[model samples]
Target: MTSPMEMDKLLHVAQSCAPPEAIQLIVQVTEDPHTHTFAKLAEAPTIQKLALTPEGAPYVQLLRLYTTGTWADYLSMAHQLPSLSAAQVAKLRQLTILSLAYQERSLSYATMCEHIGLAKDLRESVRILEELIIEALYQNLFTGRLDGVAERLDVHSVTPRDVPRTADTHNGHDAVFGLLQALRAWRDRSSDAITALDTYKRQVEQKYDARAQTMQEDHAALTDALRNVAQSDTGMVARMRLQETYPDAMDVEANRRTHSKRRSKRTRA
Candidate 1:
């Protein structure tokens, strides 16, 4: 039987390897009862060592797999770890929901690495927001019944009223509400626009141009909200000034561009 420490060392080595092999090794190590691989590693000395490594490249790849593997397995692992804060729990739940909806069965190893590489707190926040959007989508789209509409229309004939508004009714409204709530919770939530743009670019490259366009539009709307606070004053002059001053604020768009460049450089380095 392999000692726990030996299993840890081998797991580390496996994580350092590339591709399907790394994943395969992880599966094997996790299955080995002698390894104590099931134990929480959050406070382990090894975890600190791994985290201290530059950008946690190898460790993050492994952590991602641990967090997002088979749902039941991951959940069991999560329970073994240090108890999460309310915010952390919320975020993880959200991430799970979004992962199921949008990236289920198709999440790439690279994408998983990116998510796990994020600062722990930030990772939690992203997970929460993603899950929030997913729940909103589910609540708005799936749980509702169309029977009322059909009964009202009194015919099997296809019509606007008869057709349920899946995208527009649920996802659209929920997206707006959820985005606003998320922004309020984290004012410095980084650029939703930039995140959306990156996601869109990736999706487009993957031949999901239509989905990219929708994401782009959603990002644009959220970006506008980020810049403009709702005000009670509605005088024509106030409205004009709001419109006029908005352009100046928009003109400061240079700052966002510069920030983006800096972030890209930091990531590359």
Candidate 2:
């Protein structure tokens, strides 16, 4: 069996020319003792080109696929087929669907059949989807399954395809401009986040300020009430002084009694 790399080389050569020349080149390839060349070819390309030729017309449309061509191009190529062989037509149809699956990811059987103008009847549409998936699997063009319950194609992988390279390559100025635009977008997002945070901080500060003011008012009122109570009750001040001057309440009371007794004795004497 040819390795994937060898097949890639063969396909690359096959793509370099029109169908006739491409077919010839692939056929002419041979494996040598020292030289590296692919010997075998897939018949799909020849079939695809024959299918692309229309009946009663000199024009031969060669459709590019699985490389630089778009989904639309593949579909157009399939539509161009005119009374080709069954196998040839099947190859082209399956290839077109693989491209479509790669693009859409998931597509309903009915919708796809309608898009590709498959059989008009419902039963025929489902049959077509199942057959196409089987063909794609055999060709290694697509890895997908039919969802009978959902009436859809569940695609896992498809042959790699890429957009055609554009001629207008960007220069240093374009790169710089792109970078500047990205930076501006980031800065704008940062500014918005900062603004939202500032607004939240201000709200929190206002709540904290209001709570602190209320606490201060309560503290002042309680202090004033304690002062008023001290002024009205003379005993409270005396008790406080006694507690400060004497170690015990009994000692302070004993001193007061001694002074009173001494004043009485002097009067008596």
Candidate 3:
């Protein structure tokens, strides 16, 4: 596998060279599936510098085409890339399939043939299309199955292509803007969810605290009531015991008080 580091080294070489040499190297990188980082390569200062030159504009445009354009895009460029190698052309067609699968899950054979420039008879085109699908599957470009009966490619998943920063007739700006809006919407939803969870957590904690406080108050009141009841019961039992010990004590005490009062009155007289 061609690594990002290798691609970076190649880019550095391309940048230090003259415009013609840089264009050649960039094209080589674009054609190689493992080193296909045209999105980054296209934005390099060397490539941009090349674009400023009249002779380098075509090559710069070709790099941009590889970055985000499809096979149909190449055909529509008025045969400007007549010198592109057969292998490079085929690679571009394969990348076109990836782009199609990214856009839609199900692809009919006819659609693939038209898009990939398979201008053979129906049977031959279908065969070529199947071969391309198998190649892509082997490369792990996408997860999909070829439905021979349906004559369609049912894509389960696909890797997304890099979106171009520059505006072309394909409306790259709209795509970038739409992606930004989606990210912002996801952020807002996540924030709202977090806020709701925090509120719910606080509410549950508050309820538990209040319930504990109420239980403590009830326990204290019950303890106080029990103590008072016990004290009252003890006092009543002591009084009953005293009565049992001296049943006629109250009558004797009353008589003694009357006698003492009578003697005191006689002395005073």
Candidate 4:
């Protein structure tokens, strides 16, 4: 926070500095998020005037994003704009997005590209992705494997970036809009989890059903086998005490056939 008096003093000094000098003051002040001076200069057309110069053009663009740009629009400018301090801010905005897209320490390259609206050019996409990864690594944003072969950025750990609540735009409406976005994201994730759980449950049920059908068939076969054993009595009655004594050693089912054959032979003789 800064005093009204101090803000006026800074603004007056910015006004006195001519051309590129004024641009430097504006960039330096706005870069530090602590000062509320940006809102006042933002209200005036002075920063917009800075856009006339090449160097000032970058600063003006940065100020516009600070005061006027939507979150999505702000994030998408990283690759479109030339390398400047504003581009750094754009990268930070990108980091905020990636932080949300990550899952269990890994993010697929395709998903990242989709989330960021990566350029269609394969070469450009690779260049931007490498820059993003390097910046994240250098800034200690997270740590993990950026596997080219695997085609995914696998993070082992992460620290989330803070959402900006700048003097230019921090109000109830902003908060509510942010909340709505968060809820929508949560809803999407919940739906995916439910779908996956349902799939797994169906698979388990199918396996159980197949196994149950097999058991029923086995039971039916065993019951039929038992019925055949109980109903058959071709040679169950013992002819004599010798037949009973030798029952365990006799093949009664086989002997019945041969006995008829022997009787027929005796009759012929």
Candidate order by TM-score, decreasing, is 3, 2, 4, 1
User: What TM-score would every model get versus the actual structure?
Assistant: 0.20, 0.39, 0.61, 0.37
Q: Once superposed on the true structure, which residue ranges of model 2 sit more than 4 Å away at CA?
A: 1-60, 63-83, 138-140, 162-269
Per-residue lDDT of model 1, residues 1-269, tens digit only: 24567856775665455444443444454444333222233223444354455534344334433333333334555543334445434434434433333323233323333443333335464454434444534433112222222211111111010111222333235445544675675555566767888999897787777778886885676466544544434445554564465565445554887999999999999
| Cα lDDT listed for each candidate | 0.43, 0.54, 0.76, 0.59
The TM-score obtained by model 3 is 0.61
- Candidate with maximal lDDT: 3
Q: Over the stretch 43-132, how does candidate 2's per-residue lDDT look in tens digits? A: 335434643445312122222232233334545565553334454344445545755775566878776676555764578767866886
lDDT of 1 at 266: 100
* Error of model 4, residue 171, in angstroms: 11
Q: Candidate 2 at 146: error in angstroms?
A: 1.6
Give the per-residue lDDT digits (tens) of candidate 4, residues 1-269.
34678778777776666767766776666555344224566444566577777767766666545443434655567464445475545454445434543434677666666655675348777667767776666655577778877777778766433333443344324534655786799899999999999999999999999999996886565456445545767424423433444453235533865898999999999
Quality of model 1 by C-alpha lDDT: 0.43
Index of the highest-TM-score prediction: 3
